[model samples]
Target: MSLLFSEEEFQSAWTELDEPQLDGGWELFTESMGVKIYRLYDQDTGLYEYKVFGVLDSCPPELCADVYMDLDYRKQWDGYVKELHQDQFEGRPAVYWQVKYPFPLSNRDYVYVRERRDLDLDGRRIWVILAHSSPETPCAERSGVLRVRQYRQSVAMETDGARGAKVFMRYFDNPGGMIPAWLVNWAAKSGVPNFLTDMQKACSNYAAYCQRK
Candidate 1:
């Protein structure tokens, strides 16, 4: 049902459990908050693609997936989100997100299409979400914001019986403009674990949020 990926690609997402490396060059990057991060350098772009594996010990798999896809709730919890909305582009669902950067840095934005799938693999449940930057520019360019042209992301969450869920996430996006390597590296080291921590809190508050809605 994804306009961006074929059925084979959808099914192949589950294979991340066994083979996390789709490309052959991932190296151990860091580990924090019980999460292990791996980085793969792209010689073509001089950017690093990151793959992360971790367990959300308290949040349920479905809750984690829902929290991730809930754009409205995201605005309430994610402080970096300046503007976000969903749209239809070329008959496919697309999302436009404007993110606020630290002072002295210009804000960055993205226009991408995303899809989510819930699969029952021999009675085991899996949630997969894939997002890619649209090939063609779908929306008008903003005046002061830099638009990121290359981005790719995928997440696979597998339930672990009564424990919780095991999560695998891979993503890369070139934040347009000249960004310091140290800044990017620091974000990778600290940003992911911080996001996961916030997400877990958001998951715990989701039921209450929905009730208020």
Candidate 2:
């Protein structure tokens, strides 16, 4: 939750966030767009990633949660989130990053990095396995992508992330990629929207709440 990216990474993301011009907020600016990019972590739900204006005005909490979960390509993007047990959980050094476009790609689902858990920011103890999703379709309104990022930490230097020396997976996805943005942007947009990123945030929050209860 604290600033995860380096100053350079933060500045680069800032440019990307501004290129789209979506009323990037100060809270969003400070968090290095990861806040919006990682909105689900804070809100415990999804919002239209491409919302031009504050279009989603408001909705019932249950309705928003329900809508958010279904729009993602990942199965039960929300339900998959249960709880993290403090006792059984261990830290991992690798981090995984996943991104999904509006449409499905042929021979998709192959974008996963090899031994991805090994990727981290400057040997940082945090291992973030982030996932994203987009329905296999042309881009349209409310057709924003969904993303989920899990921060994993290694429990100990001796554990080898718990799988001994064997390779372990850090990322997963439903399947597919999107058509060129020019095509999607050229066509009319449609549909209710959800974001995997927001869903994971919601899951994280719910899990924390459950842990407290």
Best by TM-score: 1
Please provide, for model 2 over 189-208, each residue's C-alpha lDDT reduced to its tens digit, 9 standing for 90 to 100: 22112332343355445544
Where model 2 places Cα greater than 4 Å from the true spot, the runs are: 1-6, 14-107, 110-192, 196-205, 208-213
Candidate 1, 139-158: lDDT as tens digits: 87889899989999888898
Query: For model 1, which pairs clash?
Result: none
RMSD of 2: 16.1
Q: lDDT scores for all predictions?
A: 0.85, 0.26
Deviation of model 2 at 164, angstroms: 42
| Maximum-lDDT candidate | 1
